[model samples]
Target: MKDAEKLAAFCATIADERKADNIVQLKLADISTVTDFFILCTANSEPHLRAIADTIVRDAREKLKVRPRKVDGKPASHWIIIDYTNVLIHIMTNEMRELYQLESLWGDAPTVSAIKTLRKKTPA
Candidate 1:
């Protein structure tokens, strides 16, 4: 699939699982030309943070036929990174989010945020 499609599908699945809020997918094509997109989202707690990371990993593999090469930062919910060759998903708590602000660091990318609210569909 195209980078845009992979990103939209990834973000949508995360939203569907109710593991994200104010989600954003940034196309990091220019910055080192490493990944195509960087999917970012915030969760409430450690469990919720894991839930978000897990859902995205599962969905990308199951639906998109893509798997992350490595996963990190799971011990605590502060931040989690799932590294797909063409995309990287970041799941973080609100506090960590404000502190390490990825958007500011990668200012040149196009960040796409979630369209609808992902409020009440508790994790399975």
Candidate 2:
């Protein structure tokens, strides 16, 4: 896998570890210039959102020597976005996720799998 795709899978695994719900990765390379992959998951609450965000940042930096170029939205906002140039992560509350309906909005984008498999191969 490309580094971006591997990073996406890593972020997805981090979300899963933090108990984020409905995790999904949308491959946007063919359709968008904004980013390569969108790793999205739903957080249960403000604290949960913060925890997931923190873990991703810390783990990515420590494990992969990677960091997001920019991070948008606050933990309390219930919808935070972490942009890593090649990959973008969306951590949202259930309500915000439902409201945005990103999956439908990006219906043409293909969902990327193998994250679960990747998680198994990589150490935490």
Candidate 3:
């Protein structure tokens, strides 16, 4: 996998560890210049959103040796975006996710199966 793909998968894994819901990774390389990939997931509440975002930032930095170039949004806003340049992590509350419908907004972008990526990177 490319470095960005690996990073996205790792962030998704970290979010999963925090019990984030409906984790998704969108491939936007061909469709958008904003980023190569987008990792979207739903957090149950403000605290859950904070925990997932914090863990992703902490683990990605500590384990992957990378940090987000910038972060936007906030837990109180029901969304948090961790921008890694090539991969943007979107952590949102269920309501916000449903309201914004990022999945549909970027409907043209293909979805990358986070579970499949994780399995391929894992050793037997």
Candidate 4:
């Protein structure tokens, strides 16, 4: 499957496991230096975070036949980033999410979905 199609399946898989509060897809195809898309989301806690990460790993492998080239922040469970060549997944806490301000930093990226943002911000 194509990267975009695989990405969609990955997001839905994570959502099915209830590990993600919202999964937002940002197409960064135009940004040559950066990945093609940004997958930003939140997890309820450490276990939930792990579940999401695991889901992404499994789905990417089983469906796309691809895997993240590298991963970061797996130790803290605060923020976990799974980096595929053409996409990046950011699973973070509410405070960390705001502090990092990734969305603001990548303000130029076009948002393809507002799934988790539809409701008011809920505290974890």
Candidate 5:
């Protein structure tokens, strides 16, 4: 897999470990110039949102040697956006996620099986 794909999968895995809901990785390379992939997931609450975002950032840096170039939003806002140059991670509460509906906004972009990719890379 490509570096960005691997990073996306790795971020998804970290989010899953934090019990993030509705995890999705969207391939935006063909449709958008802003980023290549977008990893979006819903958190149960503000603390959950913080945990998911923090874990993704921390683990991605420690394990993959990658850190987001920027992080936007906050737990209190019910949304957090971590920008890793080629991949963007969105951690949001259900309400925020519903309101934004990023999936619908990027409907034309294809979804990638990020969890499956992580599982394949992980040893049982």
Candidate 6:
């Protein structure tokens, strides 16, 4: 897979490991300049957001050798954004996700199916 797809899939796995809900990956390369993909997931609370964000950082650094160019928002906030240049990750509470409706905003971008489906197709 390409770097963008690899990065997005990796991030999605990290989010799933942390019990993030409604994970969605959007292919934004064709339509946006900001990033190639957006990995969005919903967290249950601030601590849950922290767990997801912290593990993404730790695992990406220790395992993937990749780090976010920039990170925005905080665990206390409703949303947290991790920017990896080619891929962007958003972890948010249900309320914030509903308010922003990023999936709706980027409706034109093609949506990648659940990561679990992708994992299942690949042999362990």
Note each model's CA RMSD in angstroms.
3.7, 5.8, 6.4, 3.6, 5.9, 5.9
Tens-digit lDDT track for model 1 on 21-85?
75777777766477777777778888888777777778777877777789989737489988776
* Clashes per candidate, residues 3 or more apart or on different chains: 0, 0, 0, 0, 0, 0
Q: Ten residues in a row with the worst lDDT in model 4?
A: 1-10
Question: Residue 36: error of model 6 in Å?
Answer: 0.3
| Candidate 1 structure, TM-score to reference | 0.80
Model 5 regions more than 4 Å off: 114-124
Lowest-sum lDDT 10-residue window in model 2: 113-122
Q: Looking at candidate 3, what is the lDDT of residue 53?
A: 91
For residues 1-124, write the lDDT of model 3, one tens digit per residue. 3999999888988888888878889999999989999999988889989999999999888998998998898889999999999999999998998999998989999998644222233576
My TM-score estimates for the predictions, one after another, are: 0.80, 0.89, 0.89, 0.80, 0.89, 0.89
Residue by residue across 1-124, what tens digits does model 5's lDDT show? 3999999988988888888878999999999998999999888889989888888888888988987899999889999999999999998888988998999999999999644222333576
- Residue 71, model 5, lDDT: 95
Task: Write down the TM-score for model 5.
Answer: 0.89
Cα lDDT over the full model 2: 0.88
Residues forming the 10-long window of minimal summed lDDT in candidate 3: 113-122
lDDT of 5 at 60: 87
Per-residue error for 43 in candidate 3, Å, reads 0.4
